[model samples]
Target chain A: MTLVDEIKKRSVHVDAAIDELLPVVRPEELYKASRYLVDSGGKRLRPAVLILAAEATGSELKSVLPAAVAVELVHNFTLIHDDIMDKDELRRGKPAVHMIWGEAGAILAGDTLYSKAFEILSKVENEPARILKCMDVLSKTCTEICEGQWLDMDFEKREKVSKAEYIEMVEKKTSVLYAAAAKIGALLGGASDEIAEALSEYGRFIGIGFQMYDDVLDMVTPEEVLGKVRGSDLMEGKHTLIVIDAFEKGVKLDIFGKGEATQEETDEAVRILTECGSIDYVKDLAISYINEGKAKLDALCDCPEKELLLQIADYMISRNY
Target chain B: MTLVDEIKKRSVHVDAAIDELLPVVRPEELYKASRYLVDSGGKRLRPAVLILAAEATGSELKSVLPAAVAVELVHNFTLIHDDIMDKDELRRGKPAVHMIWGEAGAILAGDTLYSKAFEILSKVENEPARILKCMDVLSKTCTEICEGQWLDMDFEKREKVSKAEYIEMVEKKTSVLYAAAAKIGALLGGASDEIAEALSEYGRFIGIGFQMYDDVLDMVTPEEVLGKVRGSDLMEGKHTLIVIDAFEKGVKLDIFGKGEATQEETDEAVRILTECGSIDYVKDLAISYINEGKAKLDALCDCPEKELLLQIADYMISRNY
Candidate 1:
């Protein structure tokens, strides 16, 4: 089957499961604010990867659905809170939760989703020990995400952030969840520790690449397609790989974190970074990581599910948004 | 031991445990923001109750210390977020975390604490099944607290929230954690389901009374004693039981939720609520609930720990802040 078909099929399964799990409750606004983002359209990439990873390891689709839904909920939870902190007004082609519900409502909504993720995880049809391990992975990932966000925010104020530091932040901020998703799926699928670790490493690499591609997309994607401001990373003074590369390549530009920069100025900054070959530099890095990710999957048995995993990584780099 | 001394002793244990559990981490600001409020003084009431409840059920205090610390962490997590939402600048006699770290830092700090709570809980030395069950309760309580917060916020915009509605909100927002704390303590202490439920009921009742007493204390306590804004709740136009009772008694209250009301006007509102016997009425209710809470100890085997549980209930009603 095509990767698109597989993603669509798995997304529907995960979405339905999420809908069933999060019933609307009293004080309807909180739940509504939470469900608002969940109900909105997304690729559901994390859960799809999780389900695919489970399938690749010889597990039935049903076995991993709860964990799959859980990871998606957690992903959205982070998005909601991050949007609030970043003060982004748009998400997934809609007003962000904070925009509609206000920060308090958004905070509570994000928190509810965070708590519900664990509740759902506890209900996964697995032995208690395995479930505990999964919870530990998830909680640790939560801490890393927070740490990454702190670093991301802090780096904005720093004069210089090394490429290694930037990569570490993205790994914690973006990739840890993905790694945990794949690792959790593999673990719950009865894979041995070595196989699970391999899958986790594969996910970690792909996750890092996915984030680098996102950084590139922020500069290159259209506002309408990205569903938010373009060049926001530049405006926010975020130290994306392109920016780091440009700084190393002697591209003198002052538009970094220029919140009030005009569109022309922002465009010029993007142009400078692109002309300096920093954009291509990041693209190459993304490809390298994706390749490394695929190599880690060689530990798994050859299966169609494994092929889909490779295709998903390719799609991560190729997607416009 | 007297309740005060018992509280003091247990507070030291819980505080030390919490300090050990929450080691400082990288990106120092986030962890610092989290620990800032934690290091400030609190009565450690929840943890004390948890320890007392566990001891009452024949469990060693050490066995339940992690769960006790988890509850306190959860409590602090809610306070950090709620302060941001409420826009309060002070907490526990210090500038609220948002004041020091900015809203973004406070949000991440709270998220870190929240995730850390579950991490700590997952480490409880118990059978996996029991640990899972404890997690289930804690997660559910987290949801209820969110719901309760939503209701509290919703009630502010409301013209008249009935006494029953007020009770239910407090039950969700305040009592649920206490209930979880006690239930967790009982379960980890090897108490039977019946005994756990009894202690949970005890905590729930006391939690409700504790909040009601807090409402009264807000009106009567001086700012220095309360360690924050006194009459802040009234200023927020929250419908505490006293306010609700006065409204029911046909006492016109212009000071309720008077955000811009002068201190004199606020005092006048409090005076009216007090004159209408609403203050006494709520006080009676608080005492009754505390009594009811103590009755739950009837299910426990007689011991010094159980006697301490009874004293703690009385202290909840008698304390100023």
Candidate 2:
């Protein structure tokens, strides 16, 4: 079975883990707000991926669930605040946390989550050193996430943000968390340094690929499949690689320059994306990252734990949802 | 010189720490917007107090600067996002960070601060056990702060927030941090468990007193002396201790019913408080807490660290700032 399927096979246990982890922030004022976000359903990808990565390294998967839950909590915590910052109205097909709790509640809940994540980290037994190492990674990754958010906001106003710059932004914003997730799983499983390092690298590349594919999907996916509003990035005036590439390829798009992109403008921007072969450009990048991520996983399947990780890579880069 | 004074004496180093912590969130879009808010000048009270508390417990005063700086960074981080959620406009006689950075940048900066604090916390090198204990205190203290903030925001809509409720709120909001600061200092100094416990009590009681005094000052102090606007809590329609006291006393006011405070009725609400003698009532409460804080430090003067603790109590409850 795939990692998701494997996790699903023990869904009751995984569900209980998530349930246990959530009450830490439940009594606070923003309880409903945060719960709205957390319960706003999804596949719980980060936690699942962490487990799979742990299992892929020839370790007992259940042994790393604490780390798994911590990664998931961290991911959701960021989502709670990021949605507020991004002014996103919906998350996981429901009203966003901030939309329900108001911004203050969302913010407090986010803070609560951050502390609670550390609380969970402190609770991990028999692996004090590994726990501290995971915390260090988490702390630095969060810093990089902040840097990425800052750059993202900066890029909105700038005339041009280089493709390399775009890569750096997403790496910090998206990939570092993935890297931390995998590394933490490996650490918890007592994987060798080389194996842990490889898992981290695999996660990082796949994470970037996932984001690149997401940007492309935002530009092309039907509303029925994407669930989020069509052309939401264009509406936000965000310079995704698709738009940046088109802008570079001599597409005279006034929308990204000085004026705002309206519904019609948003559609045209997406259409231009199609005409300039931007989707292909992004797909190529995604594929290269996927290939790199797969290479890192080459040694894993030789062990019994490899199936879950390989499945994770396939599921991550290929999923349309 | 007292520890606060000593810290100011080393303003260059403190300034450097400030500069370093600031960049962790610089890339955040609203960072520039909130930079003015975050950079608003204030007494670096928390860090200075941390340094003193550390020194008072027999820790090498210099050895705790990283922790001191960490405390301050965490404090600022909380303030940045707090103002945004409260939708309050001014901090430190300037615009609130959200008002400057927009809500998103403000939120992101706060996130960065939360993460960067762990970085600073990780820098303490003397005793691993000490470091872990400090982290434990900090993690719990942070959660307490969040809980307190949660209550503070929740109180706005409730008709009856009791005196005990108010105390509980402040305990979470303010006291825990002070307790942790003193405890962390003692840990670094290798103080006896009894001594550390007592010192923590001293800091906690003092912190509670300080916040009560802050509320009283908000009622009585001139706007300029407070370095911000007068009647801010009233204007914001906060369910403060004074307001709660007045509410519980059944002081007849034009406003009633369990609902969030409104800006329109704030002036009238202040008049009601004055008529009901609530200002004096709250002041007495502040004095009682201050006395309790002093009692916690009664035996400490013999240790040479007692003076540091004593002077801090005076500063906490007596100083205009």
Candidate 3:
């Protein structure tokens, strides 16, 4: 089967598991609000990564399904809170949780998801020691994510941010969860620590690549395909790698951080970034990271699941949105 | 030592553990924000309960220090988020975390504490299976706390809340952490399930009493001692047990939900509630709960730690503020 088809098979299981694991019960509105963003679908990429990693390490789908769901819940919890922090009103083409339920409701909903992730994860049927290790990894990843977000917000208020700072922020904000997912999958599948470490490295590199390419997508992808306004990072004054690289090259774009730009102005800015090679620089950097991530998987034995993992890494940079 | 002195001894250890386990690291500002309220002095009652329970179960203070710190972090985490949701300006006689760092900062700070709680709890020196159980209890307790907060907020929007519903809210919002603390202490101390179960019950009952007494204190304690405005709960129209009972007895509170009240108006309302026996009714109920809590400790051997546990239960209802 193609990688997409394989992921779909697993995604269906994850959706079912989420429903069974987290039902709307008492205080129904809070539960509904917590489920709101999770139900509004994305690619379910994080859960796919987790399940694929576990499968590659010889674990069956059923054994790791709860872990997959836990990772996905953590991802959605971060998104709900991030959207509120960023004041973004739309998520997955629907109104954000805060938009519908209000900020207090959104905060509580995110918190519920946060706690439930741990609750479900601790119940995953595994050796107690291995499960404890995974819990450590997941919790540490969460703390790092919060730090990454804090830095991201802090960067917005500054005049300039270093490339190193931008990378650290991305690594914490986006990549660590992916790293945790792969590492956890390997550990739960009973892989040796060495192999688990490699899988974690693989996830870390590709996650960074995925986020870097996302910056490129914002500049180049059509708004309709992108599902949000194009060039939003520039409009919002985000210190993404692309903008940082452009700034380092002494490229001047008047619309940078202007909060809003005309279509023609956005086009002009994109044109300048393209001519200056900032966009290509980020794209090539993303590709290199994906390759590095793929190289780490050489530790695993030759298997179809490993091949699928490689394809997923390539897809990270190759996808349009 | 007096009960106060005994608790003070454990509180000091918890404070030092807090400093060591959650030091100011990179992203100094965020760590500072996370540590702000935690450092601000409160009674440290939850951590004391945890250490005392563990001691009663034949555990040393050093062995369960991390778990004790973990529970304290959870308590402070709830306070930080609850203040933001309730929009309370002050906590523990200082500005709330949200007031100091803004909503986004406060949210991130609380999230950090939450993930750190799990992270620290997982590292506690114990058999993996036992630690995992503690993790389950803590995570489930957190989810219940969210449900409790949601119910508390929901009750504010309605005109009348049943006494049972009010009890449920108080149980979730205030007492579950206490229960978790005691239960975790027992588990880590190698207590049998039966004993741990009893300690959990002990915590649950006293936590309810503690909250009910808190409402009474708000009405009767001097502002200087209470550390906030007197009768603030009445002004804010919180549906505490006292209010629900008074409403049931057909006692009208003109100042209820008024958001502010003159000194004379507040005095008149307190006088009316006291004259109608609602205040006395809640006080008696609180004492009964405390007594019930203390009775649960009868399963323990006649030890000083057990005596201290009994004393702590009495302290739950006896303290003026």
Who wins the lDDT comparison? Answer: 3
TM-score of each model, in listed order: 0.97, 0.90, 0.99
lDDT of 2 by residue, B20-103 (tens): 655625353544543454456667666666666666666765677777767776788878877877776777777777775677
**What is the C-alpha lDDT profile of model 3 across A1-321, one tens digit per residue?**
878898999999999999999999999999999999999887888889889889989899999999999999999999999998999888867889999999999999999999999999998999999999999999999999999999999999998999999999999999999999999999999999999999999999999999999999999988788878889899999988888988999998888889999999999999999999999999999999999999999999999889989999999988887
Q: Tell me the fnat of candidate 1.
A: 0.84
Candidates, ranked, lDDT? 3, 1, 2
What lDDT score belongs to each candidate, Candidate 1 first? 0.89, 0.74, 0.94
The C-alpha RMSD in Å for every predicted model, in order, reads 1.5, 3.6, 0.9
A247-274 in candidate 1: lDDT tens per residue?
8887887777767578788788888888
Q: Which clashing pairs does model 2 show?
A: A150-B27, A150-B28, B33-B100, B33-B101, B34-B101
Looking at model 2, residue A28 earns an lDDT score of 46
Query: Residue A296 in candidate 2 has what lDDT?
Result: 91
- TM-score of the second chain of model 1 compared to its true counterpart: 0.97
lDDT of 3 by residue, B93-179 (tens): 788999999999999999999999999999799999999999999999999999999999999998999999999999999989989
Deviation of model 3 at A163, angstroms: 0.4
